[model samples]
Target: MKIILSPAKKMITDTDSITPDGLPEFIDKTTEIQKWLKSKSKEELKTIWKCNDKIAEQNFNRLENMDLYHLLTPAVLSYEGIAFQYMAPSVFEDSQFEYVQNHLRILSAFYGVLKPRDGVTPYRLEMQVKVGIGETKNLYEYWGDLFIAENSIENPEDIKGFKRLGYAFRPDLSSEIEYIFERKIETMTR
Candidate 1:
C-alpha cells in the first residue's frame, strides 16, 4: 500500500544522510514551474510565498542558484518538520528504510509527487499559492487532477480502512466525490 505525506516547509541539505535514488516523476513539469518562479521578482515571490522579507530573500537566493540534480538529498531526510523529526530517518534501520522507500510518497507543490528517495533541491512553494503560470490561474489549476488521477485507489471503499489511523470520515465536511478524514487533537496527541 502507498502512503502519501505532506512536504514540510522547512527543509535542509543532507547529502551525507541517504543518497537519493532518482529524480521526481514530474521533473519536466517542475522545470516549467521553476522557470515561472525564476521570472518573478523577489517582492513578487515574497507575496506568493506569504513569507517575511528575510525568508523571501533566502529563498530568492536559493532560487537563483538552485540545481535540481546536483547535491541532492533524499526527500525523507531533507524535510525537517515535527513529523520528520518523529520519524527520525537518521536512526532508521535498513529494513525500515527499505520499507519507506517502497511505500512512502511525499506531496510537493514544486515537484508534485516524490518517492522517499527522490532527489530534490530546497524550494519554497506551497500548493495553496495563487501564482499564475501561463494560462492557469493558480497552482491547483496548474496541477489539475494530476495528484488524484495518478494516486487514486482502484476501489473507493479501500479508504475506509484508514480510519484505524484515528481519522473519522466526515461526511458533513465532504464535498461531492471528495472524502474528508479528520481526527481529534486528543487522538492525535496519543
Candidate 2:
C-alpha cells in the first residue's frame, strides 16, 4: 500500500538521528531537471518560481551548489511544512519508520517521486511549475504516468483507496492538488 505525497516548500537543514537508507531512485532524472534549472538566470528562476527576491536568491544558490549525490537528508526529515509537521516522522518508532519507508512516496517537481527514506536536497519547485523538459511544457507533462507506471499500480479502485487514505491522513495537503491527483490516478488506471 504505497502512499503518494506532495513535497513541502519548507525544509529542515539540521541533521537528524536517522540516516537515509539510499539516494532517491530517480536521482538521475532529478539531476536532469536540476541541470535545466541551473541553466536559468537568477531572474528567470525568480519569475518561474514566482517568489520574492530572498527566496529566489537562496534557491538559486542552492541550485548552483547542489550535489545530487551528496549532502542529502531523508525525505521525511527534509520537509518541514504543515503536512510533515503533522506527520512527525522524526519521532516515529523504529518499526513505524520502517513501515513508512516502505509504504510512502513523496511526489516532487524536481525529483519526480521519492521514498520516505530517499535522500534529497532543499529546492523550491512546485508540481505545477511551468518549467519544461525537452518538448514537455510542464511538470505534469514531464512526469506523465512515469510515477504510476514505475509503481506498476493500475487498479482504479486501488487509486481511489489511496486517495481516501491520503485525504484522511494528510489533511494539510490541498484538496485541489488531491483532486488533480485523483484525475491523474484515474487516467493511469485506464
Best by TM-score: 1
Off by over 4 Å in 2: 150-190
Looking at model 2, residue 156 earns an lDDT score of 34
Candidate number achieving the greatest lDDT relative to the actual structure: 1
Candidate 1 clash pair list: none
Cα lDDT computed for each candidate against the true fold: 0.82, 0.75
Candidate 1 lDDT over 50-126, as tens digits, reads 99988999999999999998999999999997878999988998899899988988878899888888999999998
Per-model TM values vs. the true structure: 0.79, 0.78
Q: How large an RMSD does model 2 have? A: 8.0
- Cα shift from native, residue 66, model 2 (Å): 0.7
For model 2, where is the 10-residue window of minimal lDDT? Answer: 179-188
The CA-based lDDT of model 1 is what?
0.82
